[model samples]
Target: MKRTLVWLGGMATVTALLVASTGAANAISRGNMPAYCRGEVSAMYATKPMYVKTGKIVKARDGSLSIQGTVDKGSEGIKAFACRFDKKGNFIDVMAMTSDGE
Candidate 1:
């Protein structure tokens, strides 16, 4: 009985650690997004029904922002899009989109 309890306690500790680590990783992922980008993300959501599945925000060569993400759902059936922004985070244009890799 004592051994079983110890094993169960160890399992619980491991599970809690896993959950905490996952939360931290998620927080780190979007930690770098500029404040203005939040508005753009919200605006994109307003005009459609979808969620960003995965994405990255990077600084462009001209000191702008380049955002690429996979969408869950929208009217155009677009699977992914590359959204561009000026240095100040103003929406520039969607440079490209891909329904499939090919």
Candidate 2:
């Protein structure tokens, strides 16, 4: 009976450990999901034929991507603005804080 009790205790401990580990992994997976924002930003630029001065990606955390830079228009001065990307690597919204408003 003592051996049986020991075996049962060991099994319960192992089961608890497995459950805790699984939960930890799940939490990690949901921690940060902005791993694909760069690709999405590149796609947006490639699809358009406009001349963008090339912006640097700023805040890219927790699925939020922010880029602040300039856009070039021939015969006109460079326009600066900020672009934001959502979690799914899609264009959440683009804000033109300067001459070029998107």
Candidate 3:
């Protein structure tokens, strides 16, 4: 009985540590977004429906990244898309919604 309790306690401790580490990693990831992209994101989400849910830096074919997120636009529900930016801080390649349907 005592041995079982000790094993359970150890497992709980390990689980807690893993959860804490994952939270920290997510916090770091949340801010790793490029500065220019943040500003553009702000502007993009300034209007109705469009909102920046989360941003992640992903590896592309060249192992370099842009940014991607799941955005919600009013009753349109949630949609995922990649972000585009130029050296001049221009936002391009915004393929959020389709004119045919949601």
Candidate 4:
């Protein structure tokens, strides 16, 4: 009975650890691109501790992807930008989106 209890406890611990790790993995994988683009845009443009809100991901016919988002610079106002990435998820360029929707 004691050995059985010990085995059950070990299994429970393993299950808990697996659950925690899975959650972490999902969070990282799901938000990897958006988070990465946000960080890059924030660092490149934000002058005074700005806020970055990530938007949808746009795919081009050329197999490239672009992460669209807005950067809020408080007093400096807000601006829209897109972080472009290659097919393999490589950094391409960051462009400021115009009001007319470029």
Candidate 1: which stretches are off by over 4 Å?
Answer: 1-50, 74-78, 99-102
Task: Return the TM-score for each candidate structure.
Answer: 0.42, 0.40, 0.39, 0.60
lDDT per model, in order?
A: 0.59, 0.51, 0.54, 0.75
lDDT of 1 by residue, 1-102 (tens): 999999999999999999888672222223445333434553664533235543668886888777776555466564566666667655666543664444
Q: Clashing residue pairs, candidate 3?
A: none
Q: Is candidate 1 or candidate 4 better by lDDT?
A: 4
**Alpha carbon deviation, residue 85, candidate 4 (Å):** 0.3
Ten-residue segment with the worst summed lDDT in candidate 1?
A: 24-33
- Residue-wise C-alpha lDDT for candidate 3, range 41-67, written one tens digit per residue: 546555333365546555556434467
- Where does candidate 2 have its weakest 10-residue lDDT segment? 24-33
For this target, which candidate reaches the highest TM-score against the unseen true structure?
Answer: 4
Predicted model with the maximum lDDT: 4
Put the candidates in TM-score order, highest first. 4, 1, 2, 3
Number of clashes in model 2? 0
lDDT (tens digit, per residue) of candidate 2 on 2-101: 9999999999999999988867222212212222233333344443324454455555658666666555544555555565655554456445556434
Q: Evaluate model 4: give its TM-score.
A: 0.60
Clashes of each: 0, 0, 0, 0
Model 4 agreement with the true structure over 9-58: per-residue lDDT tens digits: 99999999998886722222334778877888878775532488888877
Better of 1 and 3 by lDDT: 1
RMSD to the native, candidate 3? 12.8
